[model samples]
Target: MMRTPAPRLRTYLSGYVLSLVLTVAAYLLVTHPSYSTSLIVGLISALAVVQFLVQLVFFLHISAERKPRWKLMVFIFMVGIVLIIVVGSIWIMNNLNYRMTPQQINTYLNNQGGGF
Candidate 1:
């Protein structure tokens, strides 16, 4: 019978350190606010993707799979689902924001006898 080898402590530790570094980096970026909002957000997003890869490789050991083809397909499907959900949520929120002008808000509030 073929047995899979157990993950070494070094792998876990590396994943932990990388996760910690990414978290701290993101925190520092937000707290310092040295860059433009869009740039900072883009950097954070990139960091998040890197952090996800670190977790998958070091912790999940996805790269160690004997049959990686199916795993890759599943991962792609999961990513697609996540993207759809995120994009749909953003689209809904943007549409809501577009519909709710400041003037319309004030008029609605006045009609409702002010301040909810």
Candidate 2:
């Protein structure tokens, strides 16, 4: 039987440091907003994903071990959930952006000779 090595202090420290850096980056992106909205959104999303992986691998020990298939399935399910959430959010925001405001709605109502 092969003995698996346990996680060391350095691994945890690295993950912690990376998470801090990513958090700081997200804060800076929100505070500065120097880049385009789309660009900023993409960067923040990417950073969040990287941090998630880092925490999973380093802290949660999501690596090759017993029940590898189970781990893979869980990871797949999590990815699917994240995809659904991100896609749904983007879709909703896109639709809201294209929707007419109250002013436009009033103008339309006046033109159509309808008010309620």
Candidate 3:
């Protein structure tokens, strides 16, 4: 009986350890108050994205050989579009909400009351 090589096992173990570390870091980032909530959330989001890519490439083997590169590119492009739309909508809505004047608010309230 020949012994099987362990390169794949080593790679999988390393990837698992890195994933665990990333998970812990994300948890800590969300729980700690030393940093601003926005900053911590941004950092955690970035880290999560990086970790997801790492897992895809290292553990899932999502390469040209396993699947077509075009499929991966399309997936990434779709995700980018979704992120842009969501972030843009939030930013636009926040600005609109913050910039409402007292007069505008009163006018809306009056309109709602049938101009009473």
- Residue 41 displacement (Å), model 1: 1.3
Error of 1 at 94 (Å): 1.5
lDDT of 3 by residue, 4-69 (tens): 222367667777888899999999877766798889989999989888887875686555233336
List the lowest-lDDT window of 10 residues for candidate 3: 1-10
Worst 10 residues of 2 by lDDT: 63-72
Give lDDT tens digits, candidate 1, residues 2-60: 23357889999999999999999999999999999999999999999999999999998
TM-scores of the models, in the order given: 0.73, 0.65, 0.66
Candidate 1: lDDT over CA atoms? 0.90
Distance (Å) between predicted and true CA of 8, model 3? 4.4
Best by lDDT: 1
**For each candidate, how many residue pairs have backbone atoms clashing (under 3 Å)?**
0, 0, 0
C-alpha lDDT (0 to 100) for residue 65 of candidate 1: 64
**lDDT of all predictions, in order shown?**
0.90, 0.85, 0.77
Arrange candidates, best TM-score first.
Answer: 1, 3, 2
| Residue 96 error, candidate 3, Å | 1.4
**Candidate whose TM-score is highest:** 1
Please list the Cα RMSD from the true structure of every candidate, rounded to 1 decimal place: 3.8, 4.6, 5.8
Worst 10 residues of 1 by lDDT: 1-10
